[model samples]
Target: MVNIGSLVGAGGPNRGQASYATSKVAIASITTVMAMELADHDIRCNVIHPGAIDTPILAAFADESEDESSERTIDGVGLQIDT
Candidate 1:
């Protein structure tokens, strides 16, 4: 199983979520084993986690300007389009 989730890199530079990171890590490990075990049953288990979308919470951090805030939020807007 491949998880795109990231508790480590998602909580910004200030917040250090150790518990959240540990949980995600445990979840990832469980997912990996489950996927391997369930593969014989024709079950394709996978997970997708999209980080830092253009949401209101993210907007608060980016209060300078839409263009300015969007740079850090969505990998820089001019270089990429935020989905």
Candidate 2:
């Protein structure tokens, strides 16, 4: 199984999100364990901690200037798993 988490998993900037941070950290640990246990069966597991992504939800909270900027876009690394 693959897990998607936030950059907070890497200790990035965060405020009042101890629970959120803890959960993401747990996901990383679980992914590691799954990868090791499934290796013999040709099964794979991974975790992706994406950086700031300017999605519609984020846009909703963005300032008017940011929302209006045509150049505004999501800047983050994406995960690609080859099975």
Candidate 3:
């Protein structure tokens, strides 16, 4: 089982994103449990945290300045645009 998680799981909470952060934490915990329990069956469970990808949802939550800063930060990290 592959789960999509967030860096927020380790970074903790952000303003107005309590639920989002909590869900990511839960995903990690669930993935861990699934991995342990399914190991006997040779099934693998894992979660991936893709940090700070540019998306419409990101802009919806951030103010103009924050959005610009995020863009710069993501660019600085050399994130590739697949499309």
Q: Who wins the lDDT comparison?
A: 3
Between candidates 2 and 3, the lDDT winner: 3
Writing each residue's lDDT as its tens digit, candidate 1 over 1-83 gives: 46665533334332334676766666666777888899999886665544556567555545544564345544543224433
Candidate lDDT scores, in order, read: 0.55, 0.63, 0.73
Q: How many backbone clashes does candidate 1 have?
A: 0
In candidate 2, stretches whose alpha carbon ends up further than 4 angstroms from where it belongs are 55-83
Best by TM-score: 3
Ranking by lDDT: 3, 2, 1
Please, what are the lDDT tens digits per residue for candidate 3 over residues 1-83?
89999887755655556898899999989999999999999999999987876677555433343555555644554654443
Instruction: Return the clash pairs for model 3, or none.
Output: none
Candidate 3: where is the Cα deviation over 4 Å? 64-83
Q: What's the TM-score of every candidate structure?
A: 0.50, 0.60, 0.68
Candidate 2 TM-score over all chains jointly: 0.60
Q: For residues 1-83, what per-residue lDDT tens digits would candidate 2 score against the true structure? A: 77997777765434445798898888888889999999999999989987766466455434332433312332223422221
TM-score-superior candidate, 2 or 3: 3
